[model samples]
Target: MTTELTDAELLDAFHRQIRLSGREDEPAPGIVRDTDGPVARRYPQEPGTSYCMIESPRGLGDDPDHWIRRQVDFFTGRGEEVEWKTYSYDEPADLTERLARAGFVAEDREALLLGEVEGLIHDVELPPGVQLRQVDSDHDLGRVDELMRTIWGPGRDDGALTREMRADPEALDVVVVEESPEGPVLCAAWLRYSPGTDFASMWGGSTLPQWRRKGLYRATVAYRAQLARDRGFRFMRLDTTPDSRPILTRLGLRHVADTTPYVLDARRGA
Candidate 1:
């Protein structure tokens, strides 16, 4: 029987799984902080860009607006541009308006999905001659990098990609499927584990144009979900654009909410 679940139930289950997987430890020390009120603090992926996380302020003791201003000043003081990810279910409290007032540009929102690892990792048929492989060495890394650039466009510096790859080998797995006549046409990667969470996040699901709708993407999803299940992850999470939403929904991932990243260009008005 199919094990479909409600969005809330799936999200709760997914969160529980994340706790069990121990993947939540990936964030740095100051990357996640608690503010005086319903607001929390978060850091960026690197020093150059300012990225922050704001959690639900339900029942928190302080003013959310005041806390947000504090967060803005905290990152702005560092002479860096700031980005904040806000979820659909989050109490608006004029947060987006406040952000706009502070010169933050709002970007498109993406769907936040959560599902059980097993729900995604089912048996799948692969296209004939398409071979799946795990990347391990420098050569493999280079190949993965090349595939990323080829499928997604160029301009990624080698140093940055290498640094990212090195920092979280366990968390990041680059998997690819190669087809003979078309060459290697499918490429994707996932964050296999989160330190304190039972969640594994899938990223970089880029497929070449000629290979679209060929079942390659679904197979890759199953492959990674199996890997995550084997690693004991309970939940699988991904941010999806409209193009991929149908695929994920078919895979049994329920939409938790939508998320948007708002960025402020410090150089423009500083």
Candidate 2:
């Protein structure tokens, strides 16, 4: 006889794995909150850019529309524009529609993928002179920021990134792969851990156009996976674009559900 795992069981198992590794403690770039009420937390990306993660109001007689409107009011009162990320499992059905009615626009859907760190870790070879290092100092953090701007295209201020990295050294574990001979090239970063969940998220994995198709990206991912495993984390999770879907699939991550963001630009009326 074979034991079978239900979807909920699989999700819970993955969560436990990430929590044990302590990677969930990785510091986010902005303020994080775990409070009472419908709004779980707010992540401020920059001066005017913010996002909210709501507690799924599956029970407790909570009204999704009411809770969402409260969140909008919370951010707008502070003069911050808000983006609300909703997962497929979110309850109080038609939450997205409610957000739209409240002036929040629907964004493209992306996969909320989960996988075991054990499955993702693999020995991969890097090109000659390309080295992977864990960032530790202010200078390393600055370099990581520069690399991120180069790969992802610039917008947000780097000052916020610097402040977050300095405030909580343990909150972030930035891994970089620098190419020799000219300058540092191709960099990636991951939130080693998440608070209250067993999931370490991969973020800011960008490669310069010149470095495309090389194994640098894969190596960076593997390095992070190994780090998670070393810390005893069981699961790794990420929200990815279509470009990264194939690469993640090769690493054994499975698509668990879709995540969509609804945005309310409070600035429009301001």
Candidate 3:
């Protein structure tokens, strides 16, 4: 019998085994994984793709302030826009303010939600005429991109997304809900499995405006959760917006921590 972990324990495991851990997920071609500093960094071949995953500043000893400034200058000097992901429980307190002082603009804060796969693997009854299925073809992926643009905005690009999908398609499961097989995509989402980790992260569950509140979101979630469990992962993680927090909470995901991205767009003044 598997022992249940408390939310605190789950959060700690997530930080130690996933957030602060070295890269286990495969990088796309031309993407470099840099671990020379106190944090894990991913420097993609293109500008605006580089980012740092920092779980805490304790690794920087007593002068995290200096480290923060140096990091900001490092990325900004390269004319590359980089995102520094920070967590609420990250050490040295005032870390958010420090990023702000160093010219990093804060973005929306999201709840880092965690849920057990066993608890989440339940059947969700979809509304009439809607169904969920995994997609992978270039044509299907292009449709997924269009659906995302409709949900997020027209300015979003699918180049980076399609590139990542082509690099390692097995690492992700892109699922969509439609009126019928190969029909109009009413809702869509994807599950990314981090190799060698016990977790799979959920992304992109946006439904078309007309399809909201009819259980499409929950159905996609349950669909992904089932896939994650079948693949030997024990937990599911989501960086959830406020709108999805209450629904996820009802589905047994605990809000373990808050995460905000601080972006340094060096290209702005260049």
* Best prediction by lDDT: 3
Candidate 3 lDDT over 145-181, as tens digits, reads: 8888877876423654577788888888889899865
lDDT of 2 by residue, 48-154 (tens): 65344444423214566667677777767766666676767666567777778888888888987787777788888887878887767667667777777776667
- For model 1 the local lDDT of residue 171 reads 63
Cα TM-score of candidate 1:
0.78
Higher-TM-score candidate of 1 and 3? 3
Candidate 1 lDDT over 54-143, as tens digits, reads: 444342334656666676676777666656666665566567777778777899989988888888977767778777766656666666
Candidate order (lDDT): 3, 2, 1
Q: Estimate the TM-score of every prediction.
A: 0.78, 0.82, 0.91
Winner of 2 and 3 under TM-score:
3
User: On a 0 to 100 scale, what is the lDDT of residue 237 in model 2?
Assistant: 82
TM-score, model 2 to reference = 0.82
List runs of model 2 lying over 4 Å from the truth.
1-7, 13-36, 43-62, 195-197, 268-270
RMSD of each: 4.2, 4.0, 2.3
